[model samples]
Target chain A: MSDEVVTPLSHEECWQMLREEEFGRLAFRLVDEVHITPVNYAVDHDTLLFRTAAGNKLLSVAMGAEVAFEIDRYDDHHARSVVVRGGARILHEDEEHRADNVPLRPWVGTPKYNVVEITPRVVTGRAFRLTRPWLHLTLDGLGQE
Target chain B: MSDEVVTPLSHEECWQMLREEEFGRLAFRLVDEVHITPVNYAVDHDTLLFRTAAGNKLLSVAMGAEVAFEIDRYDDHHARSVVVRGGARILHEDEEHRADNVPLRPWVGTPKYNVVEITPRVVTGRAFRLTRPWLHLTLDGLGQE
Candidate 1:
């Protein structure tokens, strides 16, 4: 680990990057079982919304019903990732509210018969970078301040 | 439905493409929950072998654990995936063999801690292509002779 330097990005910057990302893999848990799937997501109001079928992923979610949803993005040069973890559950039972029904991108057929929402619990993130010999010297000099 | 006329790759072809891929994600049921991680892997003797710590992924695969390991690749032009649904367990003892300890890349950490081997029960796979206005057809044309 010696001779390597890493720059850190702030929470706000990481959150902004995550919000700008359009797709993410959903992580779920049921009776000690873990599963993940990639899907298009709508990110707004400090939460996430996902649409899935009543398949194994959803069926498993119903077993214990407590779940965590994560969203992240990595910058190429910086090699940084912003990950937001949260608790999720089926959307509130309100057929009158059309907010959950709006599909971010319409494909075909009925858009997601099941919709779930996740409210973030903890949002911790990190950034990694390479420090070549020359780069390391420059960074060390700058850190003296 | 008839535009550029690109054809869908067969399921067999999808499997081959998946094997050619060096990176895939492992979704495991956490002993008390579920966890998933993107892993770099190599096909060894026609089975799955990836390294991990004593995390949820391995705890869930103590001896004879049913799990799902999947490989997927897609772009705006096409999307294809190969999913392995089956049993998984540790391939070696707690100590890692020196030969398998090579790193994923110079920067990425080691690929050998304890190799997890997944023996699939049903390896279901499919491929899809989106060329605009055409229906999202499953790769039913596994037109293999």
Candidate 2:
């Protein structure tokens, strides 16, 4: 009903927001179809790390699937969104030791031994806020004029 | 940190959650790349309706792209996620008038004259909650036993 402004967030702002959010949606292809799943993750510098067990998600990662990860916060008056797109890979046996220190946790008690990471090839974000008009005129006054 | 349970919501339950949530993420492939964007949308019975102007979002829909729309709610102890994979199509000129009746509204003040619809071909959802083990034991007592 009111006017609004949509601003493109800077690269630094995008990363900042991504780091703050602990949960996001991961999208990848599975069984010749596109699937998106919400994942609890940790930000490891520029890449994202999440744990998943033997499921469609893990299978996709094994297939070298390109993925898109998105996280955002929204309220009645404002919304901020960030999207990270890149290839996802499972951490190798040697890299698993470092992942143990990353603090990634799964909501369910499902033992997520498979640690997957998405190295962002492209990152972008945008923010939207509502604004009000400076002058408020009565509908009756406008009609008379 | 504790035991948890993962429950599979039925089809009816999934639809109910979809209707209650007003915001979601839309995933589509563009230029051999997977891209996901947060969108404010309204559920139209078994389908999804959202408006977008002349942008990549609209272009992807115009090209008859298969898209994935995801909406979820999560907390520290629980998470519910629903994924809808379907084919997207722009509403025809003759059908534009009916689009006005839809509750879909864009957050920004952008003139989203293009009304796109995704008729879901597959809809699935799952929920996870925390649970505690029946025999909770102290760290020292467990080893002694």
What fraction of the reference interface contacts is present in each model, in order? 0.12, 0.46
lDDT of 2 by residue, B45-64 (tens): 68888777756554554347
Give the TM-score of each candidate.
0.62, 0.82
Per-residue error for B80 in candidate 1, Å, reads 3.0
lDDT of 2 by residue, A33-98 (tens): 566788877788778888777455445543476789998886546778898988898878788665
lDDT of 2 at B134: 19
Displacement of the residue B20 alpha carbon in candidate 2, Å? 1.0
Clashing pairs in 2: none
Model 2 chain B: lowest-lDDT 10 consecutive positions: B136-145
Give the native contact fraction of candidate 1. 0.12
On DockQ, the candidate that comes out on top is 2
